[model samples]
Target: MKKQLATALAALVMAPAMSATSVDLGYKAYTSDTKSDNGGAYDQPFVKLTHFNKADWGTLLAYVKLENPGEVKDAQHGKDGKLTVKSLLIVDKQIGDTSYNFWGQNFLVSNRTVMEDNLYLGVTTNRKYGALFINAGVGLNYSAAHFDPTGASFDGISGYAAVINARYPFSAMGLKHSLSVNYEGQIDRDEDHMSTLGYDSYGHQIITTLKTSMTESFYTKLHMTHFDSWGAAPNDGIEYGVAVGFTF
Candidate 1:
């Protein structure tokens, strides 16, 4: 999965280089404390890549997160070097303040083959009110998940998904800050609800992120997310993380 994601990111980076729009790369450290050992006090180091186009199409983002990088020696699997990779691609057609888009996202976790992927058709609109700038979007999505952690093949579990995202930004003291919220709900196919052990295979998640700019190209952010499950989705807990980012 990591190799595949790296290839995809390379393609995205090269596709628009002739135009040479804009690119940013940054490193972040994330930590969380939760009741579950899976989500407990763990440190994650991640690298992020983002590309923006001068043309009409939107942005492409790719990132990889490694849990407990280089700390515990000789250990393996979930405790030592768990890997997570994510990628997103957005293509948009804009008409004034509104933009219609088709987007796709892929997520994978290592030491296992649990993967989630989704595609969405959405519209986004931006507006300004007083000193605040607001951006919002909604999408209809189709999602699929595979949970063969041991490499055994299984039937793909499919679902219908809905997504919403909103952001509000304002400036103060010559610095910019923004609050962003995102929500996703996936409802599994009725037949697949009980496919993953005895648990329902669908999930709903909400995340809020607050970012404050330190400089024109550097920022600090805090993210909080809550996962709700109808039956027994994997991400059924709360997580909080802080990150620092830079753009050039």
Candidate 2:
């Protein structure tokens, strides 16, 4: 069946990403106001956490991933918060089974942050979709977001994004700034999302992160994407915001 094939292919593709010795976890919270409701999950904001790590096995390696996520909203308040959990894994091996270097990817899915179950792809050893996605051994970061204003089906509002980035410690100033240029698109919806005549609305975003600083063990700060929806204001209203994060 198609499902089984997809699962098998996903496992093969994820083999390389899980071959590392360390892992990192990140969380973020953001809020924005958009115009209408597309009946889809748009500006339906929430909190989320994602993690990835590497392992070593003389000739083969195991790459693991996990994410715990949550979200709150401004549109349709009662149906506001949706929570979900997911697990991801992959492996890696030398290209010719001779050398010690290798590469791979990961497959992750969620019910809360996803609709009808979707598969997301990621790379390891700094490779993305066959592209050289590394600035300094860090990694590439990207996300797709949408906000719909019209209370329609799957047609009215949507957003998409792609960004490749890296970061390192700056001991001198106790600060680290990640920089990237990302492209994003926002699409509007109609009453029937899967319909042929579904031309509702859309917009684009090009953004950059200016700086990030760690003031203490309990706090860190950063800024990103001063986005202005292009053409027709795809979803609602938002350019960028200041972000502050803390951990125990």
Candidate 3:
């Protein structure tokens, strides 16, 4: 499954590059105070490579981050030298001349350093209302994970998943800006899988971002994230950060 997803992602990256409508690549740095249920807090700085691509067929967004780059050894959370990758692909088809469209979306997050991977596939509806655009769908969720020290592993179809995303763009203080929100939820989860993975049947995450362009090629963003019963430890936490980047 991971191999198949990787292949599809590669195709999206390469095929879209030939005639991409727009592409942006930049560096991002942020700090998060994310904590696990066992009272382990991961308040570390992270650096990432961010990429965004848009074309007639779809849009692709990816972030690859290295946790605690400055630390020589693992911190309290043992995340040093860890690499995390999160990506999303959306393919759309317009619904006649209306403001609605049909979309096929794929979201994947891989934390190879921790031996975890999550994949979600959804058929969504996208609609535009003036400057606000929204996309939502329900789909399937697959998860695989391995625990360290204990050496336990799990892999299977975990449950049903729902995804929602919204964006609104405007001008403020003479700068172009946008506000976007994203949500992902795991529902109807397999009880055994949830228990074995140390997560909940209804894990979810909500992220909000306020972004503004400093110039035509430069931008900044403020982000806030809230999550519960998600990730590796059935944890809940809130994180906030800022990022600056440039676009070409």
lDDT winner: 3
Could you tell me every candidate's TM-score relative to the true structure? 0.64, 0.38, 0.74
* Candidate 1 Cα misplacement greater than 4 A, ranges: 1-34, 37-43, 57-81, 95-99, 102-113, 121-144, 149-157, 188-190, 197-202, 230-235
lDDT, candidate 1, residue 14? Answer: 61
Q: Order candidates by lDDT, high to low.
A: 3, 1, 2
Task: Please write out the lDDT profile of model 3 over residues 153-213, one tens digit for every residue.
Answer: 7788888888889999999788999999999888977766666657777888899999898
RMSD of each: 7.9, 10.3, 6.5
| Reference-based lDDT, residue 193, model 3 | 63
lDDT score of residue 43 within candidate 3: 47
lDDT of each: 0.54, 0.35, 0.65
Following a full C-alpha superposition, what root-mean-square deviation does model 1 have from the true structure? 7.9
- Which runs in model 3 stand beyond 4 Å of their true positions? 1-40, 70-74, 77-113
The collision pairs in model 3 are none
The best candidate in terms of TM-score:
3
- After the best TM-score superposition of candidate 3, give how far the Cα of residue 98 lies from its true spot, in angstroms: 8.4
TM-score of 1: 0.64
